[model samples]
Target: MKKLVLTGAAGRLGSYLREPLTKMCDELVSTDRVDDIGTLYPGESYVQADLSSLDAMLEVIKGADMVVHFGAIGDEAPWDDILQSNIIGAYNVWEAAYRCGVKRVVYASSVHAVGMHLKTDTIGLDAPHRPDTYYGLAKCFCEDLASLYWDKRGVESVCMRIFSCAQATNARSIGTWLSYDDLIHLVERSIDSPVVGFTVVYGISNNDRAVVDNSKAGHLGYRPKDNAEVFAKAVFADTPPLDNKDLANLCIGGPFATVELGNSGVAALGVVDDRKET
Candidate 1:
């Protein structure tokens, strides 16, 4: 590809993706609201942009072959915030991509988009949206927007509904964890694949106890190499036993599944201060 643009360049996942993404394109344009980004890959350049403003987004994606959109307030924020970042920002990306003639969009969608679904039932790419929070609702809106762009304007999209993608701290992560190495592989396949009109794949590893189903969108050739199961023994032993009566514990979204709309589940988890250095 001539150019690849990544939206959430300062994010933890985005930081990890920079080196690999830089190698895939002659120019890798990384953008975020934050002003500082520590080291950069040889071909990578940083751009400061906002999600809500179409002009800002368009300016960053002007000369790109494809876009990897990971920008936005990642956790559950206020309704207005979600409206601007997740909703409006998502539209700006697709619209700008269409107007600028970008071929494909690789999105960082979330499992919270379908978090309210029961864990017992294995959901696929086509599952109906049961967003656990306003944040999740934004994901649903973008997925639909991707579909609309594909059907109407011929711009392709790939929405990967990621599960828990962090350090494996608890048992829930064992089923939802998506390792950094596996994540790099997934994005590579999404970019190099021959053609994909509009597809949704679970952003998860090949774990022994994965809860989500990915068979419906297996054509992308995303074969994850990591597994969270190895950490299960230590994680489960150190944590408290499961609370069967709690809807938050049993549901697929975990705390997100039961938290009231507009509430912050991330706060309850306490301070997560780790920032990826470039």
Candidate 2:
């Protein structure tokens, strides 16, 4: 690719992608609302823009071969905030990509889209959307948006239902943790795949106790190498026993399924690094 655009370049996940994406193209246009992203990689550049503004997003992503749309509020919040950042923001990205003639869009979807389901069921990409919160609902909307764009507009998309891309700090991480290396691998496979019209793959590592089934999305060639089992003992050592009555412990969505709407579900489960660390 000659040019690639990456949204949410200032985000922690984005931090891991910057250098790699910069190498994938001649120019990597990294955009965020921040004035700057501290330091830029060799072929990377930053643009301060909001996702809710279609015009601004179009300007930043236009003339790019593909877009990695990692931009969005990554946690549960008020419906008003989720509407602007994730819902409207998704439309803007897809519409902008369409107008810009970008070939593919890589989205940062979440496991919360199917969070209400039982973890023991081994749900697949074909599983119905059972969003636990407004945040997860936004992910479902975007996944559907991608499908619509593919059927009507010929724009391809890969909605990665990322489980958890942080360190294995808890028992749940044993099954859901996706290392930074695996995250990069997943994204690379999503980008390099030959045919992915509207693919939906779970973003997880090869954990011994994983609950998700990515068999249908194997065409993407995302063969995870890392295993969360390496941290199983360490995590289980300090983690408390699972409570059958607690939605946070029993359901796949964890605390997200237990939290009240318009509240911070992510806060209820202090798992990932919330700070925008680079």
lDDT of 1 by residue, 90-158 (tens): 999999999999999999999989988877787877789998999999999999999999999999999
Candidate 1 residue runs with Cα over 4 Å from true position: 269-275
lDDT of 2 by residue, 27-105 (tens): 9999988888887878888889999999998899889999999998988999999999999999999999999999999
Top lDDT hit = 2
Model 1 TM: 0.97
lDDT comparing candidate 2 with the true structure: 0.90
Candidate 1 colliding pairs: none
Over 4 Å off in model 2, which ranges? 272-278
| TM-score for each predicted model, relative to the true structure | 0.97, 0.97
Q: Candidate 1: deviation at residue 140, Å?
A: 0.5
